[model samples]
Target: MRKILTLILMGVAVFSAGYFFDKYEKNTCRAGVAYSIGNVDQKFNVSEEQLIEVASKSESMWEKAVGRDMFHYDPKAKLAVNLIFDDRQQSAINETKSREKIAALEQSYEGSFKKHESLTDQYKEQAKLYDELLSAYNESLNSYNSLVNYWNNNGGAPDDIYNDLEQKKASLSGQFDNLEIKRNDLNSLAARVNDLGKQLANITSTHNSNVDHYNVQFSAPKRFDQGDFSQNTINIYQFSDINDLTLVMAHEMGHAFGLEHITSSASVMNALMEGQDRSNLAITADDLNAVKIKCGYK
Candidate 1:
């Protein structure tokens, strides 16, 4: 009678364990870890089957560690494997728009340069004209002084010669005044050219900043996993290598299993891997321990 009672209790305990596992699997959607791959198929150059295969392999790593089918494929499951484009593409778009702005500024610069070039030529011509007029005035003044000396040394000077001297001097004085005005205009044109140069420098600086901003955005060479735990969705990006792709899926799926990143390099939950050490892709003893703890497995 004692042996029979022990056997009945053992059978009941085994049945209870099976029932609990079934309930746990159904409640957690572990039986069918339904997922959808995103439309970024072309961007990654991977087929749907390839992506699915990688995800399944990643899932199997965890499932094997727990010694059970923890997750299965379901098309309508809230869990998902999605390919996402990094902000680099948006940064590229921003850079393109910035270039367009610079292009427009360049167009404006061309116009300003042409205007400055024309002004430069005008300034040169005015300067040359001023020099010639000054020389002529000096020569005329010298001739006038000589004539006066001639009159002083000799006798009665012609009234016409003095009149001609005065008229020539007055004409030369007017020309000098006109040249001074042209010089002022040339200075103004030079100031405008300086301002245009400053504008071009500003545009060039802005273009450089846009490029620097893009580089900063894209420099990390890393991937991202986005999941809120509410939707069971995992969005991934920035990984191109097959091994890297598998690593991200496994890591995020581990999160779905309530596993956190451990400090050990032996575990896949190390936050980031260093090299082509595919060993990181597998579930380590520590990882299995974590799953056991999370799932309350003996």
Candidate 2:
């Protein structure tokens, strides 16, 4: 009976050890990290659902690269992914707004320049036509005056000559009328050109002012870590857009997975955001190798 009891005790100990080891592996090793969306600041203008979707997408990158799951979403998970509103994010937001304003101002300035160019061209053409018309009017008037002077000096003119003078006077009057119309048109164009010039000046002033403001406020090179993992929580402080947010989240998730920063600039585990490809975020080979090493894979 004692021998049978010893064998049973050894079997119980073996089973218990195996059970706890399996649990440990699942919780801290092969099963990956579990995370959940926590505080999403309203200032971000994003919903928790949107964050979850992006987080899921980010997780899928690692999972797909390794052909296994690297993250799990659990409502009760200890890891809380938070979008915390702070000065970092506010600065980024302000920079974005300023850039947008500057872009709009630039567009307005370009449009005004094009309009000014076109109007200037029109003004030149009209001015040229007016000058030509004026020259023709002056030459015709001189000829008419010469003819009248000859008739007056001679004391009497033939009926045919008088009729010709009358016809010349009518033709000169018609030319004068045309010159008046052309002069008015040219004046109108000049006025329009002047108005546009003023408009362009105003736009330029505004654009320059905006540029100055941007330079004053946002020109400094800011290099802060956008997110961090600590105390079992991930705090996201700043991101330029949704893609940036995803890449930041992925970077933090790499930390949560017990991976360290890699030297490769293109790796998701890189220390700096400058080299990360936010648009086409994926786990590089370096990241995959790091994860494999961390999880005890060969």
Candidate 3:
């Protein structure tokens, strides 16, 4: 009787385990994990101001990374990878690859061999995790290649479609026990995100009247401003963003030209410039000449 009961329970456990794995395999990336640039194309309507800022920012970063050398209808440049907003951050600040962790990872890279002349269950667990990570890393590579191919064909696909790419990066990242592979993958994404950030920074810097020129970068909404440095550079924060910075572009240009912040919300140079007007993507002359003043009066 005892033996029969033991067999029944074992069977039940196996069935339950199989059912769970079936569910997991069917849904690889989970909900909200694989946002494609396809959806961003259909949605994401932006005002003119936002458009200029985004275009300028994206272009600037793309230019700086590989440079604008291959802009005239090049398929490869067009298909280059873009950073997802969620993946754009400073997470690496706390990132660590400790010595102990490194040694363990190195061991994982060698692949498991028998210890005590037997393959124990411990080996099985490590092997499973290693294989899972390897699969995920390959998937990311495939995804990047496909996107590049599409761009090279001039497919007009929007980039940054996967709104949750950052989150996905974290989860898929766990599959690799090899620290070097993990580090390289994480660094690649980090470098791309940093490149986007540099472009955004240019937008803010472009408005400084005090400096020869400034760089601006914009990716999100955050309350920030330049308290001083009005003597050397101008930093304008407009509920600052990537999508709608054209007006802020004008306002910053005004500061760059020697104009003080304006009270007239009606004026483009007004410190209180709103998004609607800014989205028009226009910069006024008063703002222009101030920059020209540094260049010499006509």
Q: Give the top-scoring candidate (lDDT).
A: 2
Instruction: In candidate 1, list every pair of residues with a backbone clash.
Output: none
TM-score of each: 0.44, 0.82, 0.22
Candidate ranking under TM-score, highest first, comes to: 2, 1, 3
Q: Write the per-residue lDDT of candidate 3 for residues 78-146, one digit (tens) a residue.
A: 122122122122221111223234445445433323231133344445556656767768988677557
Q: Model 2, range 113-163, lDDT digits (tens) per residue?
A: 899999999999889988988998899999999989998999967999999
TM value for model 1: 0.44
Q: Could you say which candidate leads in TM-score?
A: 2
Model 2: how far residue 259 lies from native, Å: 2.0
State how far residue 13 of model 2 sits from its true place (Å).
Answer: 22
* Stretch of 10 with least lDDT, candidate 3: 31-40
Candidate 1 per-residue lDDT, tens place, 216-249, comes to 7544533233222235577765463677678777
Candidates ranked by lDDT? 2, 1, 3
Candidate 1: misplaced stretches above 4 Å? 1-26, 29-32, 87-230
Rate residue 148 of model 2 by lDDT: 92
| Greater-lDDT candidate between 1 and 3 | 1
User: What lDDT does each candidate get?
Assistant: 0.69, 0.88, 0.39
